[model samples]
Target: MTWVKLFLGSLAVSLSLVATAASMPDGCNCFCVIAGRNTTVDGSVMLAHNEDDSGEMMLNMYAVPRLNGNNAYLWGEFPGTSVCDHFLNEWGVAIASDGCPSREDREDVTDGGVLYEVRLTVAQRAHSAREAVKIIGHLVETRGYQASGRTYVIADPHEGWICSVVKGRHWVAKRIADDEVMALPNNYIIDEVNLADTLNCYGARDVETYARERGWYDPERDGRFSFKKAYCDPYYYTYEHNVIRQLCAQQYLTGRNDLVPDPDTLPFAVRPNRKIGLADLMQIMQCHGENSEHKFVYKRERPWNHPVGICTDVTVLSAIFQLRADRPREVGCVMWVCAGRPCTEHYIPWYLGISRTPDCWRRYASAAQAVKDHFTAVEHKRDQWPHHIYWKGVDRWASYATDWHNGIAAVQQARDKRQAKACKAFAKMDKKLQKYYDPRTLQVKDREAMVKSINAFTEKLYR
Candidate 1:
């Protein structure tokens, strides 16, 4: 016997890599970044995200008040995870996304498609970011993209867009140019296209003849058809975990020593080497690829056998937003959250002219019972998460990612002494609520003292 058939083919390739790493899916390891408004330092068209989902999820927030006629916005809920919800509206626009997994395994959809109404129909009907990339290419070319592709990014207060959806009715979009800087992962970082450049691209008009009738493109051995190299999903888009988190967010936004991790020599947007902010998008969304030789093994019950960072260990939440247009688009559209893993918490900020977001950060009292309990992937309960702030950031990020090098310098010295006292109480609460509003009809000139001074400085930075 040929050595008992090589020990039963090495025990059936170690039980099919432990049944494909225990059937991986706590929502595709998300990450995103955008900059644009002249590449940041507060001219603000910035965007940032990292909502890496994992089990027992529940983190909601709603201010959603323009019911059925849509757009009153400020929802972030993640109930039943249809593309891990996020938004911001009242015409400052804003949205977030990252799970890009396309190479369309053709569901060619009609109805069970359009996962969670494509960023809530571009935050209830776009107000800009070029009408949210034409409402995500007309809801993925008329109700098509159900899943296995998504990108979104969309912004306002002077533009920023990304929109890379594909899983059926093809898509593409791009526009981060007011002096560039984009970083994204979870795949599809939109590559070369021009639906004849209608002011910097938009999607599908047979998107390269349907990727050359599904041979996934071959413009003579693929010379120019680059929708992320012919519609990504090349085994998780050539993973080294989305190429070392988009080369650790363009080497922390361009201090770049010749960036690598070669997804065809990366650069779907760059220009930084200076002016980016919100503490460099919260230190590159609390990066862990810190000078990569690779070794931050945050497995958290086998989150795809480790090695995926731009902060992981199921980065429950982390945002940045900050979409300013030099003043009152209702208090310059802030977001800056963290309810966990911005390297173990502390971000807080909120404000898009708040009117309520501190009933211990809510949990479904109606947005139609949280979109009828969305896709129902329930877990979050344990006595309603010890009265909430997203379960104290999922209990201090499951004890600081279970020993992230001896508790990351005491969670970055108590999250940098509460991010320098909540950014000096948000610059004295934006100079005392921009004199109770009227920086040209952002209206509020004393709407109950600007919603009681933004609900008492967002409940005094969530206590």
Candidate 2:
């Protein structure tokens, strides 16, 4: 089924679907905050993501080994998939993506490449944001992008890049200005491509030629070739949900009340009025367009007219990558991940240096085990299955929050308190660990102990 249909159908059954569907939801949302060295509270670059998927799936983490002396990285992985949806390497490079459906003329049905493989290759090999962009362009040019178009957000400690892929072998990537912040809501955000600006723009050699041949662009009539206008699916471009989500994100980031919700004129990236911080990015990720016309209501009677919020029933995980170039590689990358709905769940910090993932965040040992745990068998009576502890905890909160009438505010407040406490505890622990030991030299046992402690603390917070 098409993503649009899947998204709408999921919304219709959102309240009724149980925690058994392991598939990712149709559409996703994400953003990146590129804080020039001075545009942040602590002068640190930050990238935040809301990985909206079929809320039923199990979320897992893996520590990918370094390849030929390349940096090792930690990424969120699923049971049956090879793609790393969200990842951070030892070099402080982070990558996240949202699927962007393309117009029929721009679809690349011949490309034998998968979207996840592109993301994984870039995450594993690229050392910087710009390099990641070039890698994506090269992959598409040679292997072809097989899936629907997608927008990838790649960032390092200094800057961010948005690489949007069209079907087949054409793509374009643009760098987010050092002082700008960008929010992507499952649609192409690059308006125009500047081939001459090698420092900031990268694209296939036939990007414009292909569009012109297809009658999607005209040099004489159209001032310049727009990647989004030429490639984006018309339905997605005019869809109210996409437009509202983009506008809401832009308004929140710029703090502008007068801006209108028009996709054609929306800036690809904007400079924030003040330095952006981790907390600000977190709040934006959780935004539901509340108290505004674009607010997303979860009532069965109300049709799905707006974009899903940061805490939708379909969101499996949300993460923020805190990368600091000032710190050593061992202590520089921190991924704050919330395994369930962002509204009721607290983000727990996982250091990039950690060698092991707690059992609660690990995937099932085998496919049989996965089926038994999530589908066929019911070992835990109260939760209906013997899923991982993390999932059990998520289900507990979701039961209440999904009610929407009485449980939202209370869950939101409690989650906020828990997250704040966890953040503070993480800061203290990270400081202590970095002060005495280099993460690179830490023994496996030491890493395991740290992970256990953090996992234990997370369980306590939920309890």
Candidate 3:
């Protein structure tokens, strides 16, 4: 009786394993990196679902997580298992070719293809791309396959951003059913995608253009342009292409810079060609933090109408500066309000051309530490009570004169802390988390403690 019980228990465990395996999306293509090879990948296609978009139709790939900084690569290109919908957003199976697409020009692959659908599987999500690649070999050996022109599979070259199977390119229309998959020619032909699109997609063109213009492409300069330049200025790029606008404004107003066309001289700073003058440009650059777009509407009581294609950070700055230049009385009102204060009221300039960033501003770790230190200092000032207790619902109370001084001190302390401990903590967490913890389950023992720790780390920011 004891032996039978043990056997049954063993059988139950085996059945559970089988069920779990079966429940995972089965019969999908997988890829992985070979040992000691940085660029090459090996994998197999499980053509178990002979028909397109029928009978457990699923596709998956194993690749490296992209390295973003320095040498940017796509996230899917990195070492990881990625579950991609074969029917990309219900548009048909897309096969990205060997290169990344440009942000502005790359056409959507989904818009033209015959639609095929596939489901996602846990194995695809749970396992690393490398492990998936290893298992795919055996899965393919067990399940015989069929030819579907729609199934476009290719390896990625180191330079290639993607191994795309675009809908209108390289593949023919095919029907995928539960029992059998059919392949038929659809007269679709492949075309060479433009490199500019690839550069723009991964965020390179503007920097490339800027670097060449600024003579920043010198090999002696460590063979690299500024990382910040190469990466889209998120402040500007996040909204409209404000860098282009800023450049245009500076060039047209200054008239001597040889970047874009110059604007016609006009009575107002805004030119007929929509270029703004030097004064307005400087004001915008100073006040709006270089990349700011004046998309935010001021209160209704403010006398400002949206400018035509000129409603940007520069426009507002131009308007204010022009007012100050032409009408001194208006300028006096602003200066009166802004003068006398130690820091907040003063017009300090922040520019992108600075050679060094304050240690506090460099990374999140330092920034956080700075914040934590400030909170400590501020708490001490507030009679050892949390600021939240006093300034809880007070909107912009920190800007008040008395409160402002305290806030500034607290911020400086935070910034100092960020430069010291924050950086160390961030580096330690990065190393430890990558080594010891599964990133998915990041919950801590106490939520408030975690929040406090995080707040203390980041509170030292200047902006």
Candidate 4:
């Protein structure tokens, strides 16, 4: 383990101090669900994510068709933004994250700290979830993390890892057990750091010593070294709205109303009473927290200022990754992506082997252009949104939210009908397609033919 031993100005990270990230609200949060293979009905590792953000944001989905040399992947892109992107590569590895603010305020960054480049490197370079975590550790330790903090939920076919990062050179990652499920909000949920458990953990070597040196921790007073307790901001960690969203998922799986909204009280991960399915996980991600034991009074006009609940008024997009090892990665990995809010838009299946995404998904500028435009470009205005799929769902969601309870029924009815059709179409496509690829080498026997079929099927779903 190569641990970079550079410590900048030492200042005690105050529990009272608040953290701010690049162009995001303090209350903003994203929800991610990691279901280990043994906990799911089909025994496939499931990772579900809802990208909660507001503004005239745009989402673009495109496949990087360079699998021969570099890795090919389906990039879930948010143009002109640093932290709000997701990816699924050719190896069945998928990555998404929540902006979990930490207590580290020291400016230890080199090259403006690593932000957008972190996830992109994982997508382009990593061969497995473990490799992805190692890549993140190297980048953060050497370059430093740019955001307040973030917990990246990365998973491959066989397992899932929740990699929690601080604002500086300290970080930790833990693997989810096969029988457990983890639901993460904006707060840091990884409390126990067992770096000795090398098989299930990977992190900085001086994670505890650095905190102690900075006066952030004292083993005499704090007992064992809790990375989360020493580094996470108390205000953000216990923020009512975000933790409630985490509890909502817990409630559904445990069927227990007594589960508290606090992270300390709630189990780090819950064992579901029964095996979970795609639909069950979908319902969990779509929750508005209406049925939970605790209720929230809408502080702003927008629900969670339009970004709370597992679902939200400001959710630009959502993804449910069904990652399996039973077959070749091309046929094994699939992302059920919804353009906008889960409540308003239907989730369309996007297979990993597809040659290309629909034109509507690629109407934005190229990948290199988007990265350059991340900080320089102006936000797109509302009226301009109707031209693309992401904004169309945003516009539709905003309209339905006017009537809310009354307006949601008809829209959901039509969306469900379309959703059922998509599921049926995907089933037929998978059955016809799975046999053509070799599972041993993760290669397709007939790449061009399979690509053609995938593109045609994806086009039908888009239309």
Best by lDDT: 4
Candidate 1 Cα lDDT to native: 0.74
State which candidate has the highest TM-score: 4
lDDT of 3 by residue, 1-463 (tens): 2212222323222222211111112121111100111211111111101111111111111111112111111111100111222111011111211111112212322212121111121122212222222222222222211111112221111111111222122211111111211111111111122335423112212434544554534546635443222222122222222223333333333443344321112111112223232223223322222232323223223222212222221110110111111111111001000111112222212111112223322211232232123212321222332332112312222234334434655644543454345335434533432322233453233434433433333233232
lDDT-better candidate, 2 vs 4: 4
Q: Candidates 1 and 4: which is better by TM-score?
A: 4
Model 4 regions lying over 4 Å from their true place:
1-26, 67-69, 303-308, 364-378, 381-386, 438-443
Model 1 lDDT tens row, 190-308 = 88888788898888888988789888898899788788888887876877778777887887788777777878778888888888779888988888787655433432456232234
Ranking under lDDT, best-scoring first?
A: 4, 1, 2, 3
What is the TM-score (0 to 1) of candidate 4?
0.90
In the range 307-382, model 2's lDDT, one tens digit per residue, is: 3564455666788887776655545667888776666677887777765556555554442343223223322432
Instruction: Compute each candidate's TM-score over C-alphas.
Output: 0.33, 0.81, 0.19, 0.90
**Deviation from native of the Cα of residue 451 in model 2, angstroms:** 9.6
Model 3 scores worst on lDDT over the 10 consecutive residues at 330-339
Tell me how candidate 3 scores on lDDT: 0.22
lDDT of 2: 0.66
> What is the Å distance of residue 128 in model 4 from its true position?
0.4
